[model samples]
Target chain A: MRGHFNYLRPDCVTECLDMLDQYGNETAILAGGTDVMISLRTGVKKPRIILDISRLPETRQVEPYGETVRVGSTLTYSELIDHPVIRQEFPALCAAMGCVGSLQIRNVGTLGGNIANSSPAADSIPPMMLRDAEIIIQKKGSSRIQKLEKLIVGAYSNTLEPNELITGIILTKIKKGYRESYQRIGRRKSLSIARINAAILGRLNDSGVIEDARISVGSVAPSPMRMTNVESHLKGRKPELKTILEASRMIAQEIIDLVGVRHSTEYKQPAIAGLALKCLEDVFLDSSVN
Target chain B: MNLEIDFCLNGSEIRLSIKPWETALDVLRNQSGLTGVKEGCGIGECGACTIIIDGKAVNSCLILAAQLDGRKVETVEGLEVDGKMHFIQQAFLDKGAVQCGFCTPGMLMSAKALLDKVENPSTDKIVEAMTGNLCRCAGYVQILEAVREATCMKAPLNKDDVTNS
Candidate 1:
């Protein structure tokens, strides 16, 4: 807000990278503007150059790369949800994206923007984490791939350098028999940020035993974390009500131990457990029961 | 520095010089005199500044004026054709959905965006589309009724008419 800023819209990724390399220290990349616009108004980020990379074709492609899918970083939530691959293969991600903001927000909010903003409560991260997502970060000359969990250091913080831009997110495809669910508890049903949310992916063997499980919960710690402890407990166990309830309790306890006690702990503890129960139940029970 | 941008607004090509920090909402209401684009929450929380860009509804408050270049934008001011109320506007009137009138424009634009894509959207789809626009007067039931009526209206509210640009 202090200095006069230049709004530059680069036509391609290379041009964007070139501009970023030159003005890396004094630029703010604009993707969807859902988060960047808010920061600009609050004076949280004052940059000499507002780099508009929202329209680059290189960052908007959703192509299948062998076994995994590479989602262009700038693809909006609405666009991603509409893709047939996402709707058929990643229902948990679809639900998470649907839960974000609303239709208006989803129309413009990008998966890359959500990750770049690095909010602790970002709904997309938990689901992306469930799929073992990796980001492709590119600068002027070189690029690197990093795990999504490693990229986000803390609440609203990330390891992205000034010149680095997230170009694409690669998510492993779920094989046959895997069921996934995303559960969120917010202050309201619409346009509310997630207070506590979770994504659970589980698979049952032919014998009806939990063969594999992955759990990631958001808005509980510094960033959304994989509940490796609870996920390990669920593996090889019968997907029974008692087991689900016990696993849910373990997740609650794990978060409490990780975050320590706080004024909101009394509410968040039970809420987190309840969301876990719902997500687990959704993954393991809903289809069979129906 | 003021940057020159050209885009289609309400079926007409418009050229404007906008600053880097100027939002689409600010440019629409202040420079273009499109008061229908209201500014409720400077943030994206309130959908009062909702507008359709390139056939999708978005918070104009969150979009920079420079982003509007080479894009098609539609607002409530464009809902009337030949000075006649659009079918959606007629439905709102018949359903008595107007209470305070502040949120109506946003709601109508949201409805138009949905109807532009889906001819007769389901009830769940209607709720999903309009959830971003908040009516503090609690005029939701009537608003929903208006959208439902708009879908059932005999008037041919096709996509071509709404996407006039």
Candidate 2:
């Protein structure tokens, strides 16, 4: 708030693209300013040109497009939670959004900003990974779609070019009978970052056989990594207490191997296992109960 | 350097020249002459400067005045009518939701925005909406009651009587 900068408001996406194309990284895209302002205050990040692109109407919509649902980058988490299509189709995202800073943070924290900021514990990432979110990056006359996971390279790091702005997040509608659940171990219920978070999306055959599975986790390693080994173990396995426990251990071990055991691992490894087990329980084991 | 922005303030359309360094809280308290929007933490962590922009409740301290251009902004000072306080304000008074009253404005605005869209909100929704607006005294019980009371009164009136009938 104390820093001096030039403010730019572009009415159209094209204009924003032009501004970014022209000014490059000197201009920071201002969405809700929830994260950016905090970063500026702490001297963690600095931008001389603060471009306010939140007014672009086209990037503020939530709609179902063909087989993909397109969400405007500037759309706030609160709006996304209340969005009917998002709530019904991708409730995992809603659950993830619900974990973000309280209701007030949800109102101001933009989905685009969340992805662009690329924080390790970004509440929206794990669920977005469950949805296999595609980030739409655009410039004046160029556009490309990149997987959200790939765009995110490391903690507080992303592949986004300073000159390109994120336009939308496109998620393919999956028809496989997948059950989804999210669990996060945070300090408190509100405004707490996840010490470790897990999201599971999979479907069981009518015969109670695991047909396909996808597991994503956050706040464990550098960025939220997909537990593909765990997924592979469950893809053709039968749904049972033993298999679920094994899969949970597999995820916990995989996390350990990747990031190694940190001081928190004593609690986090078991916590991660428990969380993974709970997700599997909710989706595969406890279907009839709910 | 100054940038001109047009945004609705307290339900009225207004335009002002804003320095890029100024936050919406700065504008609301200084240029706009509405001090109801208080600034507590100056960071997004606290919601003392909460306001309803368009339809969502946001921390005004985190919002740059430049970002509010051409948007509808509602503040706590705007919660009163020609003579009577808004239903949420009245409910807070009746329910004793205010402790020090510093956090009351943000709480009321957050509650108003939530109840405006959802006439009948559950206890969880009330808690969810008010989570960003921190009350040091932890007056959440009374604040929750105030929002519920407003919802209870506003539910029967239907949409016709919502805006000060």
lDDT, candidate 1, A177-233, per-residue tens: 889999899989878999999999988988888999999999989899999989988
lDDT of 2 by residue, B1-165 (tens): 998999988878899998987888999899988888898998877788989988888888888888788799999888888988888888999999999999988898889889888868889888888888889998989988998899987886776666667
Q: CA lDDT of each candidate?
A: 0.92, 0.86
Q: DockQ (Cα-based) per candidate?
A: 0.68, 0.76
Clashing residue pairs in candidate 2 (N, C-alpha, C atoms within 3 angstroms): none
Q: Write the per-residue lDDT of candidate 2 for residues A197-275, one digit (tens) a residue.
A: 8888888887778998899999987899888878888987888899999999989989988988778789878888999
Cα-based lDDT at residue A89, candidate 1: 76
Which TM-score value belongs to model 2?
0.94
Candidate maximizing lDDT: 1
True contacts kept of each: 0.86, 0.86
Candidate 2 global lDDT: 0.86
Interface RMSD of each: 2.0, 1.1
Docking class of 1: medium
- Model 1, position A198: C-alpha lDDT score: 96
